[model samples]
Target: MSTIKLLVTGSTPVTVTTQKVLVARLGDEQSSHLLTFVAGGRSIIVKQTAVRTGTVVVVVSGSPGLIDAELRKAVAKAMVIRSTGR
Candidate 1:
């Protein structure tokens, strides 16, 4: 799996541990995937598109540390979903 190294574009280092959550919704009419994170005590959601067959969506919700680790986990879960032809 690849890593997401977000670099700062401005001066002065800004350190923040963002929490992320993965969600997968499948219904008879439509399917959707989402990645939600927390910043400043607020919840941020990142919707995923272009999902193909056998794609898995995982949800990681918790503190920054937990979310950080779950990011990798989400990818791994996705791979598994693909393998299972879900």
Candidate 2:
């Protein structure tokens, strides 16, 4: 299990800790991945898409946060374990 500490900035900045996270590639899209986690009694979903131009775009929905860039980084740092015997 991987733990991520998120620093959410808003009117009052606060830090949120999340341990349960899932990272997976969507279908056969090599440049896209899905990240899901629970925080503040709500589900957070982050879709990361990487382009061939060396640019990455992240779209976050659910449980809105002020620090979107940081949230994206935390989601990207999550450990994804895949079973080869599937």
Clashing pairs in 2: none
lDDT tens per residue, model 1, 1-86: 12233435564333334232333333112223444544345645544332233434444344445444455556566777667877
Error of 1 at 54 (Å): 8.0
Q: Candidate 2's error at 37, in angstroms?
A: 4.2
- Candidate 2 lDDT over residue span 1-86, tens digit each: 33455546554333333333343342322243345555565765545443221233334443324333344454344322122222
Against the true structure, whose lDDT is highest? Answer: 1
The list of candidate 1 runs beyond 4 A from truth reads 1-55
Q: lDDT of each model, Cα atoms only?
A: 0.43, 0.40
For each candidate, how many residue pairs have backbone atoms clashing (under 3 Å)? 4, 0
All candidates: CA RMSD in angstroms?
Answer: 12.1, 13.4
Q: Give me the overall lDDT of model 2.
A: 0.40
Point out the worst 10-residue segment of candidate 2 by lDDT: 77-86
